[model samples]
Every structure is written in structure tokens, then in C-alpha cells.
Target: MAFEYAPAPESRSIVDIKPSYGLFIDGEFVDGHGSAFKSINPATEETLAEIAEADAADVDKAVKAARRAFRTWSRMPGKERSKYLYRIARIIQERSRELAVLESIDNGKPIKESRDVDVPIVAAHFFYYAGWADKLEYAGLGANPQPLGVAGQVIPWNFPLLMLAWKVAPALACGNTVVLKPAETTPLTALLFAEICQQADLPAGVVNIVTGAGDTGQAVVSHPDVDKVAFTGSTGVGKAIARAIAGSDKKATLELGGKAANIVFDDAAIDQAVEGIVGGIFFNQGHVCCAGSRLLVQESVADEVMAKLKRRMGTLRVGDPLDKNTDIGAINSAEQLARIRALAEIGEDEGAERWAPPCELPSAGFWFPPTVFTGVSQAHRIARDEVFGPVLSVLTFRTPSEAIEKANNTPYGLSAGVWTEKGSRILHMANELRAGVVWANTFNKFDPASPFGGYKESGYGREGGRQGLSAYLKAGA
Candidate 1:
């Protein structure tokens, strides 16, 4: 007999989402010049709130606000700046339960994930950067490293609050004011964060949020005054941003897409490898940029690993994002769901064998079953491209050299994983994998103290730790 879990939904009462929201500029919520767009809960397709869309003019206003604030904010004593970050971090902790619920409702991730991973990391990022604000002289950026003026930041919907924290914390710690634009689908938490700034008594215009679609982001990036641009999203857009700022002086940092490889050697711990593979590819509905979507198992162990992986995949619970017991929630949007479907279809049409666990999806929401494709080759689209969903492609390697060759075949170089008991092999593989981050016997782990970024078409520039601080600071002359 199969065991069943009781429905345990988190209460939405803690969060009081408003009917409508506007641009957060100069520390105040103000009207946008453009039309409003509705933000919906991806799980149920229910309208959550109407978000004010920022126009080019609105973007200019936000830039001006950040520019004006930068004059006073950049010159403030380092100790004083650190206090505001500490206060923001504390306020986020005090309201974490509320933020987590809102994140689940707005972004369609599991309550467990929003509560455990996203919210905690968001607060920790702020806290970590807070201490750095007072110690930049010791940060090895030379004596009295100067701020880079205004930073234009754009974050994605996958890990909304955490991405916001990642961008905002380091920038502010380095004395740069910002005009940030949250993705259109999930703008609520960012608006709420603006309120947190007000509550922290942060000076007006120190952090500005201009909510909108791509055009608003273009405005911020192309603005003559923005000294720095930091974006986390697709590789195609990262290229566009790079092109837009080609002849300009704006410094840019991009965290883009990946097709990471997870290699399992014959002598590895099979059970632990299965768990790592699942967590790597299925976590966040596989919307992760560095998800281990490509599974490279040793030919000798492929059969055993596949059997165990299929068995484990069957046990995942897929349903309401609010349900504490839910493992996979909804796809972030109808558009993203369509993309996943299209790619899965291509996987089948290209002669790859597709498989999904026996799981019933909720009737109303945008859903895609956790899927895997076997008999995949490096030339196949499913193996080479980023599905950006809960889809994994399995391939076999005869030797370590073959594994390394197949893994680096992709144009992306974001992250990869290796599972084995051999310490020497592990160190050698870690050095050989052409990814910014490598996980040995583990995957998808992140910390605010560690720097994270990518290489080649995956984009460039670090986003955490001391290196992240340099993105907002000028090198000593």
C-alpha cells in the first residue's frame, strides 16, 4: 500500500497583498506613466494584483532619484551605511513568514522552498554585506575604493526575493544607489521590499524600484547616467544588454543560462547520487540556471542509476504551492510552460526516449511533469540546449575523458557536478570541469559568502562575496 500525506497548506492570512501597486521611487510609492499589468498566481491562474508598468519616462525619474541619492549616500560614513543594511536584514527576518507566503503565492514555488531556502538566503545576503560596508578598505580593492555611482539592476522571477537581495546587498555595501526592476510576473515582494526600506528609515531614493516589462529594463540600461548594470536572466537578453552598452562606459554583470552536467562514476554511492541528481534537476521546477540537466553516468552503472532514479522520481508530490508537503509546484508562467512542452516534444521527435513519473497535475495551473530523456547524445537538442524546466537528459560515458569531453561540448559554462569516492579523481575532475562552480558529491548549494557566476555564453561577473563587491567599486588608480 502506498502512503498518502494529509493536506497541510500554509495560511495566507499573514500576508495582506494589496489590490494594486505602483513604482517605488525616491522611497515612496508613486504612479507610473504606463498602463498597469496584472500579476497572477501561476499555480491557480488567479489575478493577485495589478502592477504599475514603468515607462521610459518613469525609468528616467527613477534614475534621477537614484542619482540624487547617490551624492549624499556615497559620501556617508561607512559605519552609518552598514547600520541601514543591518536594519533591512533584521526587518526581513522579522517579516520572513509573511515574505515566504507572498513569494509562494506570487512566484508559484513550494511553500517549503520559499520558507526555507529563499527567504533565509535573502536575509543572510543582507547581513553578510552589512559587515563589508564598514571594511571596504580591507577588501583588497586598494585604499578608499570609490563607488560606481548608480547601478541599474534587473532580476528574474525564479528566486525573486533572493535574487533581489543578491543584487541589492553588494551594490549598497559598496556605496552605490540603485534603480531596480523586478520581473513583471512577480513584482509584489520587491514592492514590499521598498516598504521595508521605508521601515528601516533608509534615506529617500537610496534604493528605487521601477516595475515593468522589457522596455523599462531597456530604459534603465540605456540611460546615459547609469554607471553599472547587473542582470540575472536568459543568455539571449544578456547578449542584448552587452550589445546595448558596447561603446558606453557602463560596467555590466550578467548571470545567465546553463546546461550543467552531472557525472556519476561507476564506483559512486548510487543512492546518494540519485538524490543529488533529483535535487539538482528538479529543484525549483528546474528553472535554475545551473541545474544539472545533463546526466552523464558511467556505462557500467547507467542501468542501476536509471532504475533507482526512476523509482525516486515517482515519489515526488506535485500540487499546490501553499501545501507544505508539495515538492513540485506550478510552472512560473503559461509562456514558460509552453516552452517546456515544446522542448519535451522536440526531445521525443529527435528519437530520444522520454519518461515521466506517474503523477497527476492540478487541473487549473500551468504544470509540467518532472521528465527525463534517455538515449540522448550531445548532438541532440535536448542534450545541448537548456530546457529550463524539470527535464533531464541521460547519456553514458565509457571513460573519464569521454565524460569531460561531452560535458564541455555546450557553449555554456555555468556549473557542473561529479559523484565519486575516489579523492584523487574528484580533485582532478574538479580542476578539469570548465564551469564557474563545481560540486563534488553535491549540487545546487549556494552561500552569500561564496562568489557565483559563469563563463562563455553563460555570461560573466561574480555576484556574491568580496568579488561581488568589486562590481560596484572602481579599482584603485
Candidate 2:
């Protein structure tokens, strides 16, 4: 049965682009003289808002505001400071329905995911960190940890509001002010978050939301006054951020891209593995940074597992993101959809068999069929590049060593999944895998308290858990 959801009160899946957008600086929205750009809805290729393109000048303003607020907000008692976060979380819950609709409309994630996963998790993140405000001394790092001051956060479009919570909540808990920039492709939720801040009556200049393309992100990252730069995006951008932060006094944390391997041994539960594989890559149209895009199956059970995966994939419901029963949503953007198609073609040209479940995709929207490629080699472009769409590449391995080798072949080490009935194997593989978060018999698991990040090219630093709070802590405090 398909689930039904009340759409945004406006009921238009796509929001109209305002003539111009204001930069949320110093706790108030201000118009910027810098360039402006249009953010569009991927589901229908319609404009949602005309966002301000912050150049070096605009970033200076937002950073300055954050710096001003940090002097006061950072010194307030932790318990008293937490009240603002509590208010934000409450406002998020109150406006979750609107946020869910906005998220789905802008980012092309299923409404179910935006509602049940993104919205709730975002609220929980604020709520979780709100308690941590006064308890920093018990966070295992030490007593009286001070704020890092003026953090510059750059988030991706995959999970807009959720990523915002992951970045902002802990920063506040640890007493840092933040200047954040959402991806150019998806900025609605962040703008709405600014509204929530207004509703919370959070002090001005404590949290600033800037909207623009890559240059805007660069402005924030390369700014001199920024105490820390936290970014979640592709490995290419992650590398750029690392280099930019290097030789500078700024502290940096990156939650970059991943090409995680979902290893399924022959002894693993085939039924469970089938669902895991589908949910791994197909969830959120496979826009996840830690999405298990690689399926590393033991050769002994490859055929059976592959067959079952195909059968299961056939039953997936792909359609309107606002529809409750949609198992897959549209690709995040037109450029991303084109990239997926190009990569799937590359897989076919490289001699992999390409298959997609028999399904009709939306005609007028950015869409890509859930794709699978078999006979994948380690050297294939499809295997190497980060295809941020609903594409899966399959390969076979005969031994545990080979499984580990294939799983670690990519430069990404954000996450990996192991499926087996053997507890010993799970422990061994978890220890051996270089990924940050290892999933046993599961994939795509997330928590506000679970520290998540990547190793190697997948990027550095942790996003959740006690360790996450430390990112905002001042050094030598």
C-alpha cells in the first residue's frame, strides 16, 4: 500500500524563485550586492529561490557576525546556552512537515525519507546536543573545554537539514558560532532553518546561512578569521579544502565522499542481503555520501545473490517524492542525472552488463532508473568515480582477503558493510576495513551520537558522538 502525505501547504512541489535572496548574517537577513543564482527543484526542474552569491566580501560579513556573537554566546553558562538549541529543535519539530516537503521538493529525496529520516534526525540532533551543552566536562575530553570560535561549515545537498544539524548542533553545544553555506543545488531547508532561528529568538550573528555556488564555499573556507572549516562533499572538494586549510592556522574536519563496499559472504542471509544491497545504493536515489555503491559478493553465492537482488529491485516503487510509498526518488539534479547516465554508459562500454528494473521514470523531471552493472572491474571508471545517483556496480570475490582488497581499492574510506552469519568474520573484517563506520549485517545506519566520517580520500574527522563535539572545542582550553 502506498502511503499518503499532506503536501506543503502551498501544494506546489516546486517553489518560485524570488527576485533575490538575502544573506542571513548577524541573526538578521540582509541583502547582498554580490552575484545571485537560482536554486531549482530536481523533481520538476523548477526554480525555488534566487539565492545570494556571497563573494569574499559577503563571507567577511557573515564571519564577522559569528565572531561578534561568539564573544558573548560562548561565555554564557552552558545550561543557559542550551535553551536556544532546545528552542531550535522544538521549532524544527513544529515545522517538520514543511521542512520535509521542502527537502523533497528541492533535493529529490523521498518524502518518507525526508520526514521519517531527515526531519526527525535533524530534530534529534539538536535535542541531543542541547543536553551536551552543560555536560562538556563529562564528554571524556576534559573539563572546561572552550569554544573554537567562528566555525565555517560547508554542507552538501544529499541530506540538507540533517547535515545542518550535524554541523550546527555540536558547534553550539561546544560554544562556537557558525557561518554555514548550503550547496547551490539545495538551499530551501537552510533558508527555512534561518526562519526557525528567528522564531527561537537566537541572538543575532550567532548563526548565519549563506547561499551560493562553489566560490561562496571557497570564500568561507579560505577566510582568515575562520577558526575551523567543516565540509561534507566529494573527495575532490575535500582535497581542495585540505590543501586550503593547510599552512594556515585554521582547524579543519571533512566528511567526504565514499564508494563503500557491501560485502556479502555465501553464508550470509541471502534474503537480508538482497534488501541490504537495494537499500544500500537505491535509498535516496543513491545520493548518499556513504552509499554502498559497490556490491562485493562472494563468488560461491554470486549468482543466487545477484538473481535475488534483481528480483527484489524489480519491486521497488519509484515516483513522486511526496508520495508515501515511493521507494526511490528522482535524481538530485539534471547535472547529476546526466553524470549517472554517462557513467552507466561507461560501464556498458567497458563490457559490464547493465540492467535496471522495469519501471517508468518521471518524464518531466530529473530521473535515472535504478541501475546495476555486473562483471565490474576495479579499474573501471564507474568503479572509480563518485557517481552520485542511483547506480550500483557489482563484482565477485572468492576469499576474505580479496573481499577486503576490493573493498579498500577505492580512495574512499567513509564506510563499508559486511554481511555474514559468522561473528568472528564480522569482527575480523570490521578491524581490517579502513572505513570510518563499519556495518555488520546492515547498511546506511545513522545516529546523532555515532561518530561518522571517512578515512583516506573519503575525508577526515568525525561528525557524531563525543568525538564530534570536540571539533568545535578550542584547542588548549
Candidate 3:
């Protein structure tokens, strides 16, 4: 008999979400001129709050505010700036539980992920960048590196506050004032961050937020005064942003989508490999750009890996995002759920054998069971395309060379994983993988001090560490 867990939902009372939210510009919540959109709880499909949409006019106001703040913020001593960052980081830690709960409610991610992975990393990003504010001269970009005038940032909903941290912390550390836009579906944490900025006594206009959808993002991307743009989302939008700034002088960095291959060699530790594979595809309901959606197993061990994978997947609990025992949560939105379903159908039609763990889904919310498709070939749509959901495609390879070839065949070069006990082969594979970030024997791990990004269509420019700092700085004053 399967074990059952009693429902352990995190209390939502800690976060006092306002009934309606407005755009945060120049350290104030200003009413937006555009129509309001409702933010829903993906777990229950209930409206959580009405969020003000920022149209082009509001985008203009935010950019101007950031540009104005840049003059003063960039002139402040790095030590002073560092203090503000430290304060922001402290505030995030102080209210970590509240932010985690809000994030889970807004993004449909499991509360465990929001509490453990997202919030902690969000605070670490600020803390990591805080130390760099005064020591950037040693960052190999020459002495007295100057700040870009203003940075315009846009983040995705998968890890809302974390992505905001990935963009905002580094920009501020480099002395660049910012105008950040959170994903339309998940804007609460970013707004709450504006409150954190206030608590830190961060100067007005130094960090502005304009909440909205694509149009608002386009306005920020196309704004003439935004010195740099940092975006994390779909490849289609990343390309559009690149085209919009083709002839202009605005610097940009994009951390986009991926179809990463999790290669499992015959000699890998089978149990650990199983755990890694499950974590790679099922974590955060698989709403991850670098999700190991394609599982490549060496032919010698393919059957063993598949059997173990299936059993492990079957044990995953799926349901409420707030449930402490839930392994997989609701899909972020209805549209995203539909996209995942369509792609999964294509996988089935293409002759791949599809299997999902027997799991009951919440009737009202957007949900997809943890699924795996076997007999997936390189040409299979499910293998080639990023499902961006808790769906895994299993493909078999005969040799290490074949694994590398299959892994690099895709247009995405964001991230990849290798599972093997042979140290030499692991190093060899690491050197050959074209991904910007490669993991050996593990998957989906991230750190604030480590630089992360991708090559090719997975998007460009780094988002952390000393390299991340350079994205917002000039060579010399």
C-alpha cells in the first residue's frame, strides 16, 4: 500500500497582499493608466489580487525615473551603496517566510521550492553582489569601471523574486539604477521587493518596477534612455528584444529557454542518477528554462534507468502548491498548461511511448502529471522542443560520443548534465558540452556567486559573479 501524507499547508495569513497594486516608480506606488489584470492562484484558480498594468506611458515614466536616479546612485561611494544592498538582503531574510508563501501562491510553484530554493538564493544574490560594489576595480575590467546609465530588466514567473534578484542585485552593485518588470502572471513579489527597497532606505528612483505584459516589456526594451536591458523568458521574446535594439547602443543580456540533455552513462551510480533525473524534470513543476527535459541513457543501461525513473516518478506527490508533501505543483497558467498538453500530444502522436505516474490532480487548478516518453529519437518533437513542463523524453545512446552529439544537436546551449562514475569521462564530457553551464553527476543546482547564462538561441550574456557585474559596467570612467 502507498503511504499517505496529511495535508500540511503553509498558512497564507503572514502575507497581507493588498486588494490592488499599482506601479512602483520613483519609490512610490503610482496608479497606472492601463487596464488592470487579475493575478490568480494557480493552485485553486482563485483571483488573489488585481494588478495594475503598465502601458507605454508608465514605462516612459519608469525609465526617466531610473535615468534620473542613475546620476545620484552612480555618484555615491561603493561602500554606501554596499550598505543599502546589505540592508536589502537582510530585509529579504527577515521576511523570507512571507515572501516564500507569496511566491508559491502567485507562481504555482511548490512552497518547498519557494522557501528553500527561491528565497534563499534571492537573498544570497544581493549579499553576493554587495561585496562586489567596492571591489569591482579588481574584476579585470580595468580601474574605475563606470556604471551604465540605466538598466531595464524583465523577469519570468518560474522563479519570480529569484529572477528579480538575478537581474537587480548585479545592476545595483555596478551602480546602475534600474527599471524592472516582473512577469504579468507573477508581480506580487516584485512589488513586495519595492517595499523591501523602501525598508532598506534605498533612494527614490534607484529601483523602479513597472508591472505588465508584453507591451510594457517592449516599451522598456525600446526606451531610448535605458542603457542596458536584461531579460529572462522565452526565446521568441528574447529574439524580438534583440531585433528591437539591433542598431541601437543599448547593452543586453538574455537568459532564455533550453532543451537540455541529461546524459546517463552505463557506469553511472544508478540510484543517484535516478534521483538527479527526477529532480531535473519534476522540480518546480518543470517550469524551468534549463530543465533536463531530454533524458539520454546509454543503450547498455537504458532499461535499468527507465525502470528506476518510472518507479521514482510514480512516487512523486502532485497537488496543492502549499502542501508540504507535494512534489509537483500546478502549472503556472492556463495558457502554459495548454502548451504543455499540446506538446505532450505531439510526443504521443510521433510514436513515443508515453507514461505518467498515477496521480490525482486538483480538479479546479492547472495541473499536469509527471510524465515520461520512451523510445524518443533525436528527431522527436518532444525531444527537440522544450516542453517547459514536468514532462521528460527518454532517448538512448550507444556511446559517449553519440551522447555528446545528440546533446549538442539542439539550438539551445543553456545547460546540460552528465551522470557517470568515471572521473575522466566526466571531465571529457564537460569540456565537450557546448552548454554555458554543465553539471556532472548532478542537475539544476544554482548559486549566486556562480555565473550562469547560455549560448546560441538559449540567449546570451551572463547573470552572476564578476562577469555579471561587467554586464552593467563600462571599461573605464
Cα RMSD of all models vs. native, in order, equals 0.8, 2.5, 0.8
Instruction: List the candidates' TM-scores in order.
Output: 0.99, 0.96, 0.99
Writing each residue's lDDT as its tens digit, candidate 3 over 1-477 gives 688899999999999989999999999999999999999999899999999999998999998899889899999999999999999999999999999999999999989999999999999999999999999898888888999889999999898999999999989998999999999999999999999999998999999999999999999999999999999999999999999999999999999999999999999999999999999999999999999999999999888888888888889999888888888999999999999999999999999999998888889989999999988888889988888999999988998899999999999999999999899998999899999999999999999878999999999999888889889999984
TM-score of 3: 0.99
lDDT by residue (tens digit), candidate 1, 264-287:
999999999999999999998998
Top-scoring candidate (lDDT): 1
Task: Report how far off residue 474 is in candidate 3 (Å).
Answer: 0.8
* CA lDDT for candidate 3: 0.93
Candidate 2 C-alpha lDDT tens digits along 1-477? 534444332354344335556889998888876778888878788777788777788899999999999999999999988999999999999888888888898898888898888999999999999999999987766666788889999999899999999999999988899999999988888988998899999999999998888989999999899999999998889898898889988888999888999999999999998898888999999999889999999999999998999888888888888787788888888788888888889889998889998888878889888889998899998888889888999999999999998898888898999999999999999999999999999999888888998899888888888889888885443
Model 1, runs deviating above 4 Å: none
lDDT of 2 at 299: 93
In order, how many clashes per candidate?
0, 2, 0
